[model samples]
Target: MKSRFVTGTLVFMLVFGMTLAASAEVTLRHWDWHQPRMNIKLKYMAEYEALNPNVTFDTQVIGWDDYWTRLMSGVAGGDVPDIAQFHNSQTQAFLNHLEAFPADVFDYDRYKEEIINFEAAYLFDGTFHFYPVGIMSGLIFYNADYWEAAGLTEADIPKTWDDFVEIAKLLTKYDSAGDIQVAGFVPNGILGVFWLDLHYQLGGTLYGEGAKTVAWNNPAGIQALELIESMIFEDRVSEVGFLGFNEAMGTGHAGMAYSWSWLGGELDNNYPDLNWGVFRLPTFDGKLAPGPVARNNHETGMSVMRSVRQENKDAAFEFLRWLYEDTDYLIEVNLVLGTAPSNRTLLDDPRIAASPLISAIAEQVPYTNIPGEIPHEVENDYGLGMLQDLLFFGYPAADALATAEAEANSVLMERAVKWYVEDLYTPVTD
Candidate 1:
């Protein structure tokens, strides 16, 4: 059901609407990086066009790798799409170029209250530059067949890190020579999210007071690295690169993998026959107290460009308001995202209530921290990304974090957050 947050504006639109003739037609140019999402958006665009006959869409779906390059260059050349996809990670880079939610068109306070974690967007500057469609957070997706074969049941779902380790051992398979053949839990590509989740769970923060430098070399950080190191070495439940995460899971060689809710859509699309089950990330002490279970990353649909002409901008905002106000569209797109709606109104909808996967992820929303953008090199190449390699090469936990700290700080020095939200890391004390 559409909430009162939007129903009133929708009624106002209908009551004071004017039909635009073909002579005054408008074509809003839109761009996004995901083909599946674009597919969903395109379907809704058709519905939008039917309602406002004079407004049509010119859309483009760019490859994710080339998306920002093409977009930044386009913006610099004064050829920016009227509406472009947005990610909070790009807030520092594109915040100025994006338009805030127009006060006349949108109630800022309503959005702040209606969205599940609107405070998560403190990193997106003070403006609602993008429409946050959903929030993405980590989850452990397991191979259902493997779980059954291991003689596990719903009672076996892990509630804590210790429980996960035991289950992973039972799910592991060994080769003739005793080397691992099938992994019980794969951490491939987890990178920053994995590191940060574990770190935060134990009361670590990524930055110090000024947000000027690294603050992740402390006790909690070391413990997080130790836990991962032990998982790969002493526990031996998983090999560093055995068959890879998604590939192994798809082929039934891996029992579980650490990934975001978005993986649901990817796995469904790419591995149609794989039987899978997901659980929200396990906690440190078998409870939510000490810290959040995981960190969340906000997902945006389309950010209107502040640089666009008035007519295109007005039309773009009008269409976006209508697009989100539709209940069916929200439900379908939430399915496409593999998450329940970010809109609080749809949380109790039958579709979300019936899906175990969505329900599990939704439970974690309130507990997840929206740790601001992790830098590319900091998360990937020379920082947390290198921890596994360091661990594989026999680096001690403290030394591994020290190594990552130095490498990550080099990037932090250059990419210090322009603004930092202390609440982003404030733990759930309850």
Candidate 2:
């Protein structure tokens, strides 16, 4: 009887161990900077957990301004999250710290065919570190009421830079003190892509052969800068040193501004009653250029950290696959986010194609240029500052652009040397 009792106890202990192992939980920590989209992500997270009961999510949404700083800190301290969202423009900065997604994580041929501009934006060093969440395009957002008040219609929308300035002059309003009460068009704040787009529109490229030289000091760039100068000084339609000019455009303080597709959603949500319309930015020669010439592609995506444990990495990748591959979920999330679809399939979906706003933005996809796959923040900052000097401090456009080119080139050369030494400068190939 004692021997029988011992055997039964052993069997019970074995069964208990098996149950504990089966119930073991795997938690994936995620980080993203888009605080407003947390609820949408959380809903999907809950759905994913329901499907895989053994997995759970620990998600944190940080403010955009502080996010990069925090992320770099985490990377430096070796406390990075399992998965994180990063801008495509900033991905080059974190390549060494990120884990390249395995072949099975996503089907390469299908992705290249289905995602718009994926190769230009996300493909890096012969592999993809992240899956794009959305594609954003630089666009012109105009206040419809203000445009009409200036006696302009859709038919009157400018088709060339000369026509644009003329319409802008008509839209300007001033206070008793000669201060700009309503700007015709504000070109100076936050939106950094204006000059870049203008450069491309004029048949200019930012980088030269081998992606190791800066080419913005050429004729195309000079013409772009001259036009911007003409707006601020010659036509006097746009003013310098105006803060929050982009937001003011929505409040009817401005007629038009260079902005992104995301601005439409923000205006709709924050000022639902405001009447606005979207348009492609005018070209220098009054003709649409082919192949991403008038717009800049600003896309963001998700990547897994190299430091995550094997089991957690598997769970994280599975979650990403489900997040991107599920058509219904992708549509719902993007609808809430109000971003252009990264998946080309969604671009053809009747749901997306039918929306006037989405259609308008999507139309620019083929004409947008993704900036070079190099560290560009420094270049952008320096160029913008030089631009401000031209607009606000009366620096010559030629001088400012030359200075910008020199400084930007210096940065590029330094980065190129470092990347080459580390064997990280493998350019993406067709």
The top-ranked prediction according to lDDT is 1
TM match of model 2 to true structure: 0.86
Predicted structure 2: lDDT: 0.73
N/CA/C clash count, model 2: 2
Off by over 4 Å in 2: 1-23, 176-178, 190-192, 269-273, 336-338, 374-380, 417-430
For model 2, how does the per-residue alpha-carbon lDDT over 284-373 read when each residue is reduced to its tens digit?
Answer: 666664544454454566789988798788888888888878787666656656566888788877877766566766776656666555
* CA shift of 15, model 1, Å: 19
Model 1 lDDT on a 0 to 1 scale:
0.80
TM-score of 1: 0.91
Model 1 C-alpha RMSD to native: 7.5
What is the C-alpha local distance difference test score of each model?
0.80, 0.73
Worst 10 residues of 1 by lDDT: 14-23
The sequence of per-residue lDDT tens digits that candidate 1 reaches over residues 1-430 is 5688599988777666643333478989998888888998899999888888888999998998899999899889999999898877778888889888787887778778888667666425456778868777888999999999889999999999999999999888998999887788888656445877888788777767666776777899888878877888889878766765677777877888888888888788899999999988898878875456677776776888989999889889999888877878877878888876788888888998887778887878777776566777877887878877777677787888888889988888888876466455555666
TM-score against truth, every candidate: 0.91, 0.86
Off by over 4 Å in 1: 1-23, 122-125, 425-430
